[model samples]
Target chain A: MQEIEELAARLRAFAEARDWEQFHTPKNLAMALAGETGELLAEFQWLTPEESATIMESPAGPRVRAELADVFSYLIRLADVLGVDLPQAAHAKIDENERRYDADAYRGSARKAPPLSGA
Target chain B: MQEIEELAARLRAFAEARDWEQFHTPKNLAMALAGETGELLAEFQWLTPEESATIMESPAGPRVRAELADVFSYLIRLADVLGVDLPQAAHAKIDENERRYDADAYRGSARKAPPLSGA
Candidate 1:
């Protein structure tokens, strides 16, 4: 959590020093997050599953790391701007997901659990 | 960060318990991450900048939080599977970006700095 907070702080300073926060509206940040996510996907687009699994050890490793970092950075910045606690939000969602996708009922299936009544 | 490690551990357990690790290949996780990110983008797709800036205070806040969690989850899972330290990688990239984009030189600009020679 410190690492994320530190990254967020650094990002804030970077934007502030350049007066770039004006452009960091949630909409812009979200779009930038999507663009970076696309780049992350592109890193593995042509790789087989096995290759993708081993990509961090391959020649393309650095680029993949950079792309991953870009996605992470934008997500952190967006959350910071929106006043959302990134890790806490994630923890809550994981908790919800665990309950929703009961192992006994969803074993080995990619399908999502049906929404709970009124959920 | 413990938050990330814990999230990754939970995801690993979630998949293992359901016998779904076989489907968590890097390629699949990366695509899933991108899909989730697109969903995040959709949360703000129609909002004006001002609307987006205040969206977390609006009725759509919960959905945006959920979408952020989804993106974070898949990113954590993918990094876990590929053995990348997400926070560390992000920190390193931020440091690099700081050097690459001198605030003094690129102030208020959206354009990326040109690559250093042979970098």
Candidate 2:
């Protein structure tokens, strides 16, 4: 958790050093995340079926990791500036899920959907 | 965007209906999310090579999507409860990525790692 915070701080410092805060508006950040995602996807774009799986840890792994990091960094930044506790929020959502996907219905079944109500 | 909010509202309603708020504490929710994640991974367990990639939209696809949604829903719920604007946070992260993975170093290259500094 502290690592998440430290990572966010490094990103902030990086942004400050570049004097790029003016472009850090929410809309721009979202668009950038989308674009980087595309870049991540691009790594897999045109690879043969075998290539796609093997691509990681070749030249592709680093790009994928970087893109993911990019996605995470600003997410943390926005959370920080907005005053959100990410772990706490992450925990709350899971509780709702247990009820939604009750274990009895899904535990041993290969099926993903819950059983139809009362059937 | 509005759809995201509406979905969050419905989840809250569902939570309220169950009177399960006592168990909705942060720790429980996280454990539930992790458990659901394991269920998702279970779908892929023991599948042949061909089975893994072609699994989507098959019996496996729905399970995968459901698990993904499970992961996402709580993520969104946490954001909603914390009043953090998700899209906004998502956007900001992208801006930071552009500089980190400059196009010149990676464009059209299979290599994912940026060039060695000053080379």
- Using DockQ as the measure, the top candidate is 1
Error of 2 at A47 (Å): 44
Query: Per-residue CA lDDT of candidate 1, range B1-119, in tens?
Result: 37789888987888888878888899988888888888889889999999999998999999999888888888888889988898898878878777777778877766554211002
What C-alpha root-mean-square deviation, in Å, does candidate 2 show against the real structure? Answer: 15.7
Over 4 Å off in model 1, which ranges? A111-119, B111-119
Question: All candidates' lDDT scores?
Answer: 0.81, 0.47
Query: For candidate 2, what is the DockQ-based docking class?
Result: incorrect
lDDT of 1 at B26: 90
Q: Per-residue lDDT of A1-119 in model 2, one digit per residue for the tens?
A: 35456655766665555444544543333334334434544555566545544444477555544544443454455445434454444434445555666655454332464221100
How big is the positional error of residue A28 in model 2, measured in Å on the Cα after superposition? 27
Give the per-residue Cα lDDT of candidate 2 at B63.
47
Query: Least lDDT summed over 10 consecutive residues: which range in candidate 1 chain A?
Result: A110-119
